[model samples]
Target: MEGRIAAKAEQDGAVAAPRRAPSQQRSRERVERMLAAASALIAEQGSDAMRMGEVAERAGVSIGSLYQFFPDKRAIVWALAERRTAEGQACIAAALKDVGDAEGLRQAFSGLVDIYYGLFLAEPVMRDIWSGTQADKALRELELADSRANAEFLVAALKRLRPKADPAELEATALLVWQMGEAAMRLAISVDREEGDRLVAAYKRMALRELGDG
Candidate 1:
């Protein structure tokens, strides 16, 4: 009986120890710190200047721990882009929910432009990632994929608002609107608020005209 009890105890000990809940919390906190550090660094110095050691130092984590969460700066950049894309997509979707026709589309388009530009202004690092040429192949691919997805979403929204429109023409128009918005936002980053507002207003008018609402 003593031998059987000892064997059972050993078996229990051999089983994997259950992770303490605090351990998970600590891990999450560490990741958040690293991400925050990376964002600040990227924002101040651009993505090209980001280094693993700097990130680790800023994050207050060991280099090994940083690697445990992110393999490289590109991974951090990708994470940042993905997060912003999700936020921007949600904002656009919500703002356009009640929009059903050309006028509504105009309002939604302007709203989307404002939201997107606001997000970029709020996170300059995102603008760097979008316009930077120093990204890795995988990061570039991810960026392209994100842009394509956004274009598709815009096309779908436009089609819904203009059912009688040619699908190909609508897609082309959507791409034009997206490109114009991106370009205008890039220019707005270096300009004053009044100038940015004027540019956005002009683009909104042009987009409305393209949609046959003007």
Candidate 2:
């Protein structure tokens, strides 16, 4: 079974998708409960140590019911990861929606970094879910696509602020900066709080400086 799972992971890039998506409202709510339970357990124990049986127990669903929705632990993890990614993308969209001037853009850009970082910092499960994606090709592809999607918001803001800016340049710049910001944010959270603070502050300064100069 382990060998088969490894083979599937290599072949599909993602672990496994949900065995079945919920079709009814009741089924949806039950699935949500299962995912919520899984998230909490992941937060407490890390995804690697979390068990499917524990998730079923915590969600107050039978093992059979859980398996009906998710074929394995990886499916649950992927579901949670997808939810987090969507939330992150929505957060970015909202953060960059309003920009009146260069100063406003700069503040919004720096503020966005803080806001997104705060989400990951507050949710330990976000960190664990993120690490869970590292070994999968599909999730890695998803991450890159997500970066581009998120960068569109930033680029839109830039186009509004600098009406004369080249569209291609703005796009490439936004994509690079957003990707770097994500990497830096991950780094910022991986260390001691004091040092993390320093790193975040430095990243904000550098990013904001670039925004100002552009």
Best by lDDT: 2
Cα lDDT, model 2, residue 85: 74
Q: After superposition, how far is residue 23 of candidate 2 from its true place, in Å?
A: 1.7
Give the best candidate by TM-score. Answer: 2
Clashing pairs in 1: none
Q: Which portions of model 2 miss their true places by more than 4 Å? A: 1-13
Residue range with the least summed lDDT across 10 consecutive positions in model 1: 13-22
Q: Any runs in candidate 1 off by more than 4 Å, and if so which?
A: 1-26, 133-140
lDDT (C-alpha, whole model) for all candidates = 0.69, 0.79
Q: What is the C-alpha RMSD of each candidate to the true structure, in Å?
A: 12.6, 4.8
